[model samples]
Target: MKISPKARMNRLFTNGGCLDVAIDHGVCNEPSFMVGLEDMPRVVDSLIRAKPDAIQMAYGQADLLQSRPEKDKPALVMRLDMGNPYNATRHRTMWSMLQNADEPIIGALEMDAACVVVNLFMLPDEPEMFRQCVENISRVRADCHRYGMPLMIEPLVMLSNEIRGGYQVDGDADKIVTLVRLAAEMGADIIKADPTANPEDFHRVVEAARVPVLVRGGGKEDLKTVLMKSAALMAHGAKGMVYGRNIYQHANPGAVVRALMSMIHDGADGEAAWQVYNRG
Candidate 1:
């Protein structure tokens, strides 16, 4: 997938600085997220000032951002689908709301976004859903191309772990590498995934991906840990970080963003970048 000028700008902005502020929680089944509907305005305003490379949110949220004045806002990516309601009920192999395809294409156009992100979940219970999803993603990605908006994919093969009351998945390097290959074959412009727990294995995933790769944020590790992991991934030639919870959940969102930016864009060492978190 060829990166557009806007996307190239995105690479420069984010790879130069850790990508910040993904507001797609509402679609992810976070019923009581620390950031909510009412929180959008303030958070959006602050993030705009803080200047993240891009903001990822559902179509509705993207529309909200579009309505805002564009004095100092960052670029936007609309996450086109929400998980199946059954995900919360049974945690089973489930389909997302945008299974239909057309809805998300229209939403992306309406929001005037640079790209759309689709997540493909590979789980034990629903193998067929994964195939169907890949098919749908191919179609949607083609549609995105028609409108000149690139489609970014985040392929998730969850680990079946419990973090707090929610499920967390460990990264499987091989699985993610395969997912990236499939996305590229199906026409994805960018991908966000977790690095394999093993450094060498993670590097293999990155190299195998060929396309630019960004790391997803999910854990509750401290700033130093986050920076170290991000740096390690970058050192392995990963493109950048696509983070959310780490920035928004931190007590000092600005400081955290700044720290990540230093490492991502400025090539600051981990110890120096860790100061951003420490100052926070």
Candidate 2:
């Protein structure tokens, strides 16, 4: 009905690349001392000062984003799932709350959402589960196409007690490359992926997928570490970054956002970005 996804893609990228700030964690984890996303308006305001390309968040926060006085604001990316970290430890997976919500998608489109987002989990040696993941996206794909919205699928690697935290870092490039290929072929307009831990290996992930690949923020590492890792990922052909805590939870959220955008969009190294952050 609308050619919004294309425009949203453009809204989320500039001459350099995309630096999308993700604040949708509240849907799953809720507002804890750690997340600090319960007040959507305040958090959105904090990130807006940093001037990101887009802000991906749950549809519930749409009104707060639209109310901003600055018309030249970042686009909205509507998250369509929810999961809790406390519960995540139980399942050892992030998408424990994955669901197909028709109402939210409709509301998001009405709010001028740039795109609709979903997450899928695929473990190694689980053909049945893999099929299930595909089937879910297959359904969403049809709806997004009909509405002329873009679908971004995050095909996560198998989660287990393998990583230090209860997160999905498969530590296997082969699996990531395979997953990226799977998501792309399965009809993802954009793919947000866990880094294969190395640029060369992640580059294969970018190369394997037909859609553009953006690196995830992963754990709550320090800004310097995140920026350094982001630079490497971008060098390896990553289109951009979709980070949450790394951008907002910092002491100065605006400075952190600026630093990340400078690194991502202007080719500034981590240290250079850090210096800019320190100055502001």
Candidate 3:
């Protein structure tokens, strides 16, 4: 029996939204991103217990989550690309490239993944990098249609600045909206995008993408801030969130995930979500 793409995509949502935990930072090659992920098994197990709608992971580590014998495991979103823009410690030319182009969709099928993610980056003075990202998405989109798999496009606007000592997420609304719309136009089944600098402007991103837009949790922030921002984004039409460090780097990852779930599914405001986080 084969599952349809619509069915696989439906599994990634609950009550009209989703909360996807992202542990795919290992491929970024940034040691700072590895803080809570030192033990793969423990991290994966803890996340499973947290029970997010899905878990986004790179090819190598995805097995740790999907191999579980339990019938209620989180759906997997396999990352099909790797990039150097996340390397913050040293100065280097930034690049985002696919790990494998030819058989990525077939490989995801073999892994029983529900969806695949690839990057569509907008970087300053890096037209070539942007072109490469567009090409990768085009190739992946064809395979996704062929295999009946959902494709999630992560469109980011990044800048190399001394303040962050490397490429950092840029929240410029115009840039983000343009790239997000482009990603959707290019055939993204789902769009994972960063919130604009002004929370009110995020609706434009959602409108432009014309798809289920999931907010990207960039760097780690204080609990209250994260909850408040999430609430604001959701209020402005975001479908949900795809959080990385904000969940995994917390003192209690599971607690944070549950709190976020309350916001995504239960219409919990920031204060209510904060109480949920504290209870954990």
Candidate 4:
């Protein structure tokens, strides 16, 4: 049988690659780094105006999501999990379910959601953490099928330091490949991951998963750098990217979002995207 729910989600994207905005940060972290997102409604309004192909938001934002004025608002990727400090070996890296992993999917179904997403940390040494990750994905995979919704698994491989930039190191490429394949084996319709610094290595991640792979927008990279890297990612077979801080933290969020949309959907190079951003 065709995965029709996932295939039909193409309606949310343009004819080209996807440009997805992730507004789910606040629920997992304090609002310190999210300059514009502290004003949730305003930032949501800005993002909506920019017209991203899809958006990822926390389960708590259901009311705000429903209140959007646009009948054709972007597809909703409901976050089905939350982070707890105790879930990870490093207290700061915790990404686990808020309640039962299925709860958010159930609520999202009621809102006519397009997809459900959960975060996982691939820790080979910690059997309990590994088991929890597997259990969460397995449970959510079943729930998605029963509800006829698409499921997205976001997997990260991290070291013990809890350093934000640590995962981008040299060995991250192979580890991400492992994570991608693992997510696929667990039955994810889509998988989100960090882009390896070496652009070509990202293809290993895409090829390994054999599923749509969208790179996560980690930390607050410069707009030009992110757009440049996004071009490289798309050239190397990435589906697209999910950005939170890069878009929302900009002085002109709508402009930044539009620039990224141009790059992702229109295939504009970094210079062209910079021009689009500068034009505003």
Candidate 5:
């Protein structure tokens, strides 16, 4: 156990306000990642000004980040495991494609990251694969904990055709709770999962989970809709938000991120957050 759970939680909490930009898709799926890289400098500059509590990047990007001064940077978390977008398979299996424990540990040591995140999601045709992923992440979490590094586990519910590119698993609250429980039991220090579209149901998952919960953002929608949902999650006791294209792919990512920060860390209402974006 950590010497002080309260201190540890405080260090990890970001005051119940966090903005985690998911730039890990490059290594996991997107081959034209240089396109993402093209926009990264601007996106990162915007996010830093927005003052997110943390920013997530692929292990590969850590090298680039290392060259920058730490004074102006958001806290970092390196992603350890990944799968291809073309695979068309939910990440349920343990394959050599995923990073080994030593890799992230070494990266954490080198990058001076605040934590590491791994995923564990269930697929319709792969119960056995899910089991293997669970076991694999469990071992990784234990190793992370032993070294006093925080580990966040994301449990996805697999989406439907309506939102073809959705990265989050699209399931109900009860189902999400089960996945969160499994990850926490596996020794994850923090759990990131989907927020129920309904606030009441989303709160229920927050109450039941053993670890801190940061809602993962997916589902393509307008910027206002995204900000509203993210606000709702925070109001219902989510520790924070981890989102990708929702921020990076926006027409005005800087403004969008500023709006998100108002709701998250500044306690602004959705309307107030919108105002901030419009002002920008």
Candidate 6:
């Protein structure tokens, strides 16, 4: 029995919002990302206990989470591409589709994924890289429609300079809004975008996307700051967040996830969420 994309999408959200934990960073081949993830099985087990709305992972690691026998588990979101923009030492701009790029939908279905995620990057002075990203989205979009699989597009504006030792997120409002709109135009069912530099300016991104926008948690931040930003982004019309380092690298990953869930789903303010984080 095949499931409709709408049905699968519904599983990825609760109360009209989602709190997706991204454990797909290892695919970027960055050693720093492997700090907490050294024990993949343990990480997956802890995350399953945390019970986020969805778990985004690469195809190879999808089984670690999805293979569990738990009746209630996070929906799987398979990442369908890899890129080298995250290499901190050398700033090389390259993006490539995964092994199953040609038939990504089939691979995702085989893994029982509810959604598929791909990148649509806008980098400075990299026209060819930008072109590759666009073509990747176009190809994935067509297959998504054919197979009724939800597609989540991560549209990022990056500066490739050695800012803070690695490629930095360009939070310029105008640039983010432009690429976000383009992602929606290219048929993204859901858009995961970086928040603008100004929290208030994030509303413009939400408006331009014209689709469900999930704010991306770029880097790790302190507990209070992460909670406050989550509340602010939700107030700015964001549907939810797709967080990685902030959740996975914390002293207690499950605690942070629950705190975020409270803010996103229960309308808990920053202070209240902080209490939850400290409780764990």
Best by lDDT: 3
Off by over 4 Å in 4: 1-3, 31-34, 85-89, 92-95, 101-104, 123-125, 162-171
Error of 3 at 87 (Å): 1.9
Lowest lDDT sum, 10 consecutive residues, model 1, at 159-168
Over 1-280, each residue of candidate 5 has an lDDT whose tens digit, in order, gives 5432243345445665567777676765544343444666666666666666677887667655556665756778788776543243334333423576545467765777777888786654556657667766866666676677788888876654246643445657777887887777787777788877576677777766766788887644688887777778777888778877777766776777778877877898888999999998
Q: What is the lDDT of residue 201 in candidate 2?
A: 72
- How many clashing pairs per prediction, in order? 2, 1, 0, 0, 3, 0
Q: What TM-score fits each model?
A: 0.86, 0.88, 0.96, 0.89, 0.86, 0.96
Give the higher-TM-score candidate: 2 or 5: 2
RMSD of 1: 3.1
lDDT of each: 0.70, 0.74, 0.88, 0.74, 0.69, 0.87
Candidate 1 error regions (>4 Å): 1-20, 32-38, 85-89, 161-166
- The runs of at least 3 residues in candidate 5 whose Cα sits more than 4 Å from the true structure, single-residue gaps closed, are 1-12, 31-39, 85-97, 101-104, 160-168
Write out the backbone clash pairs for model 5: 92-129, 157-169, 158-169
- What is candidate 6's local distance difference test score? 0.87
RMSD of 5: 3.2
Model 6 worst lDDT run, 10 consecutive residues: 90-99
Output the better candidate (4/6) by lDDT. 6
lDDT per residue for candidate 1 within 1-280, as digits (tens), equals: 5324355335335434437468787776655455534477777777777777778887766766778878556777778776752232445455654634655578767767766788777755667668767766877776776666767787776643232234355576777788777767776667777777875677776666666777887755777888888888888877778888788777778788788777777887788898766776
Instruction: Name the weakest run of 10 consecutive residues (lDDT summed) in model 3.
Output: 87-96
Q: Model 2, 1-106: lDDT tens per residue?
A: 5444676677767874777788877665533424656566788887776678889877667778877779888888888765433233444333334444454367
Q: How far is 24's C-alpha from truth in model 4 (Å)?
A: 0.8
Model 2 reaches what TM-score against the true structure?
A: 0.88
Stretches of model 2 off by over 4 angstroms after superposition: 1-4, 30-34, 83-88, 91-104, 124-132, 162-165
